[model samples]
Target: MNKEILRLPLYTLIAGFILGIINLITIRILIRGTNEWTLEMGKTVFYIELILSIIAFVFIGILLRQKYNRTDFFKSATLLVIYSAVVFILEQIMQYWGFYSMINSYLYLPVSIFTVITSLVARISNLEHIKWLHVIPSIFAPYLFLLFSKNPSENTAK
Candidate 1:
C-alpha cells in the first residue's frame, strides 16, 4: 500500500483532534463570565466543529484530487473507519474532561457515519467525480440530527 493513500485520513484525524481541543479552550475562555456551560455554547462550538470538519474534508479532497488513486476497498474502508473511531474516542475523552457537558453525541455518530460514506464514495469513484456533492450528507447530518432528535436537553452529557 502506498503510504500516500493513508495521509489524508490520518491528517484529518490529527487535525480534527487538535482543532477540537483548541475550540473547547477558546469557547471556555470566551464564556468565562458564565457560571455554567449552556446548550447554546455547546451548539456554537459544535457548529464551529462541523464547519471545521467540512473545511478539512474539502481541503483534503482538493489536495489529493490529482494524486488520489484507487486502492483496495477494504484497506481504504479500514483506514476511514479507524479515522472515524479515533476521532470519536478523542471527542469522548474531551467530554470526560468536562469540555462537552452541554453537548449530546458531540456530532460524533452522525459525522462518523457520513464521513465513512463520503470517504468511501470518494475513494471508489473516479477522481473527476469527487466533488462538493460528495459532502452534502455530512454537511446536513448535524442539522438533520438536531431537527429529528428528541429533546436535545435530555441527551446532555452526564
Candidate 2:
C-alpha cells in the first residue's frame, strides 16, 4: 500500500460519504422494481446502510493500507475480526435497548461481508479492482438479502 493512503483520514471520510451516496444510488436502482419499498423505509435504510458502509469503508481502507504486505497481516485481520464482532454486539445491544433494530438476519450478512472485504483489501492492496472470488460476498450479499426479503414467505405465505 502507498504511504499516502495512511495519512488522510479526512479525505477517507469525505470519500467514504461519497461512496455512501453511491451505495444509496445503487440501492435505489436495485429496489426500483420492488413494490415492497416505501419511500420512508427506503430513505431510512439508505441512510443507515450508507453510514454503516462508509464507516466500514473508511476504517478498513485505513487499516488495510497500513498493514498490507507488512508482517502484521494476521494481526490486522484479527483486529478486523474484533472490530466486526464489536459492531455486531453493539447492534444487538442497541436492539435489546430498543435504540433501533433490524431483523436478526439482516444484522449479520452485511457485517460479515464487511469483514471479508476488509481482509481482502488488506491482503491485496488494490481498490480499483478487487479479486472477485475473495470479495464476492460483499458484492452480492446485501442484494441477495434484499431479494430474499421480497419473497412472499417473508411477508405472508410459506
Candidate 3:
C-alpha cells in the first residue's frame, strides 16, 4: 500500500482531534453563566462545529473515492476507527488523572455522525460490501463515551 493512503487519514484524525479539544475549550470559555443567551451561543458554536466536521468528512470521503478502491477504503476506515478508539482511551485516562474534564454527551454526537457519513460515502462510491459488523465501532464510538463519561448533574452534586 502507498504510504500516503495510511498517512492522510492519520493526519486528518490528529487534526480533527486537536480541533475538537479547541472547540471544547472555546465552548467552555463562551458560556460564562447560566443565562439563556450564553447557552444559545454555546449551542450555536456546537452546531457550527458539527457542520464543519461533516463538511470535512465529506471532502475526505470524496477524496478517498477518487484516489483509492474498496480495499483501500476498508484500510482507511479501519485506521480511523482504531485511532478514534485510542484517542477515546487517552481522553478517559486524562479525565481520570484530573487533567481533563468529561465532555458533554452532545459533544460526541458529531463524531458518530462523521464516522457514519464517511462509511456510507465509501460504501456507496466504492460499491463495497460493508458489513454491519465492520460498521459497529463507528456507530458506537460516541455512545461509548456517553456511557462512560460522568453526567453533569452528578458533577454538580459533588
Candidate 4:
C-alpha cells in the first residue's frame, strides 16, 4: 500500500515516545524505590519490552510497505542499523540517566539480544521495513504498560 509521504520516522517518533515514557516512569519508580523489579517482574517487563520493540519494527513495515517496494536493500540496511543504534542509545539513557540504577543492567542483558532479533525479524517481515512494522511497537508499548502496571491508585502524570 504505497501511500504518499506517510513518513516512517514519524512512527519511530511515536514508538520512541512509548519507550521514552517507559524509561521516564519506570526510572521514576526505581528512583523512588529500589529500581529493581523482581526477577519475575523483570522478566515480565522484558517480555513486554521485546513485544513492544518488535511491534515497533513490524508497524514500520506495515506503514510504509508500499513505499518500501521501491526502496533498495542499502536503504533498508541503513534503516535497520539506525533502529539498532536508536535502541541502544535509548537503553543506555534509560539505564543511567532516567532509571539510573543497576536495574539498568538487568534491562540491558535481555534487551540487547532482543533488539537484535527485533531488527532482523522486522526487516524480513517488511516488504519495506522502514514503515509499519518498524514503528508499531512504539505505538503499542505505552498503552500496554499503562494497562498492566499495578497502580494501587492511578498516578496520573498529567
Using all chains and alpha carbons, the TM-scores for the candidates as numbered come to: 0.48, 0.35, 0.50, 0.40
Report the C-alpha displacement of residue 36, candidate 1, in angstroms: 0.6
Candidate 4, residues 1-158, lDDT tens digits: the string is 32332354445556655665675576466446565657665445555666777676566555554343333323443443455555556655775666766544343332232343444456567554444355444323322222222233333322
Model 4 lDDT on a 0 to 1 scale: 0.47
Question: lDDT for each of the candidates?
Answer: 0.53, 0.46, 0.54, 0.47
Which tens-of-lDDT digit does each residue in 1-158 have in candidate 2? 54432323333334445554665686777678786767676556545554666466556545544324332333333343444465556755876798765544343442442534444453467455444354444433222222112333433432
Which candidate should be chosen as best, given lDDT against the real structure?
Answer: 3
Candidate order by TM-score, decreasing, is: 3, 1, 4, 2
Off by over 4 Å in 3: 10-37, 101-158
Output the worst ten-in-a-row residue range by lDDT, candidate 3.
141-150
Score candidate 4 by TM-score against the native. Answer: 0.40
Using TM-score as the measure, which candidate wins? Answer: 3
User: What lDDT tens digits, residue by residue, belong to model 1 across residues 1-158?
Assistant: 66765655555556556666777687978699878878788657656655766665566555554444333223443566554556556656876798865343444432442554555456567565656566544444322222222343443432
Candidate 3 deviation (Cα RMSD): 16.9
Candidates 3 and 4: which is better by TM-score? 3
Clashes of each: 0, 0, 0, 24
Model 4 weakest lDDT span, ten residues long: 139-148
